[model samples]
Target: MRSDYLGFSCLLSAVILQATAVLAADDDVLKRGAYLMNGPVACGNCHTPVGPNGPDLSKELAGGTPFDFPEFMAFSANITPDPETGIGSWSDDQIARAIREGIRPDGTVIGPPMPIEFYRHLSDDDLKAIVAYLRHLAVVKNEVPRSTFNIPLPPNYGPPIVSQGSPSPDDKIAYGGYLVAISHCLECHTPRGSDGHLDMKRAGAGGNSFPGPWGVSVSRNITPDLEDGIGSWSDDEIKAAITTGVRKDGTHLMPPMAFGYYANITGGDLDAIVAYLRTLPPQKTTN
Candidate 1:
């Protein structure tokens, strides 16, 4: 009877310890998700509605931003966890697939400029973190209009992603490249050809023009060219530009860059980004 009691006590203690550890791990996951969502990921930049003054944070990720291009009129979807209107009904795997693969749970394809291509590179852990962050958002009831694309969207972005991983931060350049890819920086920076395809050969050449309420803002060359790119700018200057939207010349950059979201990037991540930028081959800005 004494031995059985001792065994039962030990089992109970072990179970409690396991549960505590699991809770702690979950807390860590939520913290990482919050950081990524509010920082480098910045889903709010697109999903959150913008008013005359700027983004309406009250609505948060409730969505309904309109992207009007010659090719399509896209309305960002409400990603809030509202069951009737948002992603409340979406399983974790469904949300992850929608983000990385651009396939909705109902078998519809999400269209540009959703940047699923870049998101496809997101690590499994990071993707899980993002989904968790999104799942916990305040449920906002918003009915977002579906997007219309004159140009045909492909059946799928590419072959279904099997598994994805991130480079260790110890590898500064590689990690920075991973950050940039997930952030989809080149999606706006790189110039598109006549076919509306990005010219990878001149990846950071940066002559894409964005027209909005703030007027037309041309993306500048981000390559290592002495005259045309950040080659002459110091590392701090580059970081400042990214975080503050202020150029090396002290001129303020225009909107759609999501400087507000970028400001949350950690110093180590910023260093890595600058390190990656330093590796790009110098290219003159495209016409």
Candidate 2:
């Protein structure tokens, strides 16, 4: 009887230890995730609607940004922990998959407005941290309508690539690919070719344009073009533009640049992006 009792006690103690470990891990993850989600990456830029001046802290992560441009109309969905309104019903795995792979719980692929490209670079641990933080958010009762694009070619407008998850950490190119993704460089720089695939030949040649409130704004080619891109600009110039929203010409990059919020990206991460961008072939753009 004593032997059996000892086994039972050991099992109970093991369970307690495991639970404690899980909780500790979750707490650490939540803290880090909050910083990343709210800062650098600034998921809140779109997810949390802006106020007269900036984001209304009251609506924190309760998403409802109407992103209507000449080509697309979409709204950021609520991502709080609200069981009915937010992601409260989603499993941690489901949430992690969506963040890393851009697939919804139902296996539907999300597009455009959500900026999954940048998210595809998140490490598993970072994604887990994000999931933990998401679990603890206030569940605001906002119900955003599920997005439906009315584009005549909604299906074929962008390339039909599917994000599976982050790549092997040991692979430098893969890591660079992840950084480029989370930066969403392709979303603005890579124009679609005749077959709807990103013209790899012009990967960072820029020329992508969208109608702005006052006029059309173009994303500068990120390729290493000595004449048109950071190729000629020193590292500091690129970094300044990224962190401060100022450009090489001392003019401010317009909205959708979102550096107003994305200015929080960490120095190390920004350096990594610069390093990766330098590895790309140079391509000049007039815009």
Candidate 3:
């Protein structure tokens, strides 16, 4: 009887240790998710509704911002976990699928401006972390209107992803490219073809125009062209443009750039981004 009791105590202790480790891992995941979402990922830049003062934090991620384009009028969806109108009922898999694959549980394709093309490159681990962070958010009961697209959405973003992984941070250029992909930097900066699809050959040349309360803001050329791009700008200048929305000439950049969210990005990540930007082939803007 004494020996059996001792063994039971030992087993219980081991189980407790295992559980503690699992909890620690969970904490790390949540921290990473918070950093990405509030920082460079900046999902709220579009999803969160803006009032006179700016984004209303009380309704954070409740959604309702309208993206009125010539092709479609879309309202960002309430990503809060409210059961009645938000994503409260979505399973972990469902949320991941919606983000990375652009397909909802009901088999509907999410339309553009959502940037599913870039999100498809997100790693499995990061996707899991994002979903976990979302699941824990305070539920906000807000219903957003569906988007109407004059142009047809593709049958799917692409073949379903079986598995995905991110490049190691040690490889600065590769990892930076990965970061750029998930950030969808080129989605707005790159010029679109006559068909409205991005012209990959001229990626980062810029020329896209965005109109908002701030008036029309054109995405500048981000390529290495000294005459038309940031090739001559120092690394710090590039970083400033990203974090503070200030150009090399000291003029403040306009809205829809999400400089507020980018200001939170770590210095190391900023270095990676600048390094990657330096590698782009010299290309003049179409404009």
Candidate 4:
């Protein structure tokens, strides 16, 4: 009788320890995911609905905002883990594939403004962490409109499934370059021709025009050109512009360039971004 009781107690202790370990691991993943989504990744900036001033924090990640471009109008989807309106029904693999390959569960291509091209470089662990975090979101019911393309999509419009490894955040230039790619800086900054194709030769020269209620705001040249680009700005100045929306000259940047989303970026990430920007070839542009 004594031996049986001891055995039962040991088994109970083992089970409790196992459960505790699992919970700890899950908590770690959630923390990492939260940092990525809220900070560098800035998922909330697009996914969350916007109020008159900025993002509607109450409806965070509930989605209904429309991103209008010349090619298409893409509405951000609710990602709040609601079965009826969010990704609650999606399998983990489905979400990972959509983020890394731009293919939806229904086999349709996830069109532009999604930034799947850059996200494809996310590490496996990071991808899993993001999914785990998404799975635990508070259920919010919000149905978003389907994206519509004004022009016909090309045969191979979506990005191919690639297996590029993510750069270490410690490597300033490489990490900065990675951040720039995932952030889709070129999509907004680089000028596109009449046919809506980016002119790669003049990349980062920045003359892309986005007309809105604010007025016709052109993306500034971010290249290393002394006169027309941010070449002459100090590192602190660059960081301020990115995080505060205030330029070195004390002018406020127009909308579509949301600095608020970037306010929480760590000093290391900001340093990497500045390091990468310094490496760009000098290109002059009149904006």
Candidate 5:
């Protein structure tokens, strides 16, 4: 019996080593994919809701935060890897389809809050890496409620061809940030006039109005300005906010940031976005 136990232990160790090596081989892909999920995607800021203040840290990827809209209505769902509650039962391809096509694992269409249109251009490899990383996260097993929606969250809002000034190649971090910009992060984060169109000149300068599940909130200025934009923050600070949904002063990032899907990001890639953001012209304005 002792000999048999020894054999089992040896077998387990070997399997662990092999898995570690495999993960090492795919490290770069995971890193890049992680960047795509966090910085540009900002998935966790909104999707993976936070637990009670300093209560439990185990429910990392399990999403359940309510996402409200202008009216009192809203929706939220779990994105964890739990078999019964999260995305665990679904295959990588199914998850990818949802990211790229807005189709859910059950063949139903994921509603507007998802912004599936933005991910239509992701390279297949990037998508796969995202799947791998997500599949490997700590399973929270929390049963999140179904995501409710009012079809188009924003009324009559049609984003333009290039959401951010334009798309640049190879610089995935920049591309991701651009994706965030174009994805309408600012539309809700930045304040708008009565006419309804966003005041582009003040972009990311904050003051945007929010009406959703978390409550009536205003968007913060993300520009490079020291006072308002993220200029005063360290790269790590920005990353914490983007990844864990924690804010600059140790406060949590508010609703709509969708930090859950974004938290799987590789640490390195999130840094690159900080580098890129530092280069943008700092803007100081009161939206």
Candidate 6:
């Protein structure tokens, strides 16, 4: 009788330990997801609605924001865990597909401003982490308007949904390239056509114009063109520009650059970004 009681107690302890370990792992993943979304990824900049000052902290990721472009109006979607409007009902695979393939659960393509092309390069672990973080958001009940495009979307518009492995953290250039993609650098820097679509042929040339209270600010050419881009700027100059909002010439950058948020990026990540920028081919911007 004594032996049986001891055996039962041991089994119970083992089971509790297993459950506790699982919970710990989940917590770790959630923390990582939050860091990625709020830090380098900066998903809230677009998805969250802003007030007269800045992002309404109360509504966080509830998503009633409108991105007005020359061609059409794209409204950001509410990504909270609300079942009726948010992604609460979406399965993990469904969310992964939308992020990686730009395809919705119903087989329809998610239109521009979503930057699915860059997100497609997310590693499996990072994708899972993002989903985990999103799932844990406070279930805000906000319904966003659907996006409408004036021009016909090109056939096979987004990248192919292939399972490409992400670059290791040690590979500075490759990892930086991945970070740039997910951050949607080209979406802001690359010039858009009259129809408001990115001109891929002129990528990195940087003629895109963004109008704000500060004034009409244009993205600078980030390519390796000595006369037109950052080829002449040292790596330190580039890092300072990104993190401090001060350019090599001592001019301060305006809104939409998100330098304040980027200031939180680690030194290794900044180095990686500089390393990646050095590899871009020279492309002179007409602007």
For model 6, what is the alpha-carbon lDDT of residue 221? Answer: 94
Instruction: Kindly report which residue stretches of model 4 are placed more than 4 angstroms away from their true locations once superposed.
Output: 1-18, 154-164, 193-195
Could you tell which candidate, 2 or 6, scores higher by TM-score? 6
Q: Please provide, for model 3 over 226-260, each residue's C-alpha lDDT reduced to its tens digit, 9 standing for 90 to 100.
A: 99999999999999999999999999999898898
**Ten-residue region with minimum lDDT total, candidate 2:** 152-161
Candidate 4: worst-modelled 10 consecutive residues by lDDT: 154-163
* Tens-digit lDDT string for candidate 6 (89-177): 99988988877777778878877777776787788888888899989888999988888997665544466665557899899999999
The local lDDT score (0 to 100) that residue 123 gets in candidate 3 is 97
What Cα-based lDDT does every candidate model obtain? 0.91, 0.73, 0.90, 0.82, 0.64, 0.82
Better of 2 and 5 by lDDT: 2
| Residue pairs with backbone overlap in model 3 | none
Q: Tell me how far the alpha carbon of residue 114 in candidate 4 is from the true structure, in angstroms, after superposition.
A: 1.9
Across residues 150-170, which tens digit of lDDT does each residue of candidate 5 receive? 444342223322222334546
Full-model lDDT, candidate 5: 0.64
Q: Please, what is the TM-score per model? A: 0.97, 0.78, 0.97, 0.87, 0.57, 0.88
Cα lDDT tens digits, model 4, 188-255, are 77877767777767778898777766788889999878899999999999999998989999999997
Which is the better candidate, 3 or 5, if ranked by TM-score? Answer: 3
Q: By TM-score, who's the top model here?
A: 3
List, residue by residue over 34-62, the lDDT tens digit for candidate 2.
77676555677678877777777788788
lDDT of 2 at 77: 82
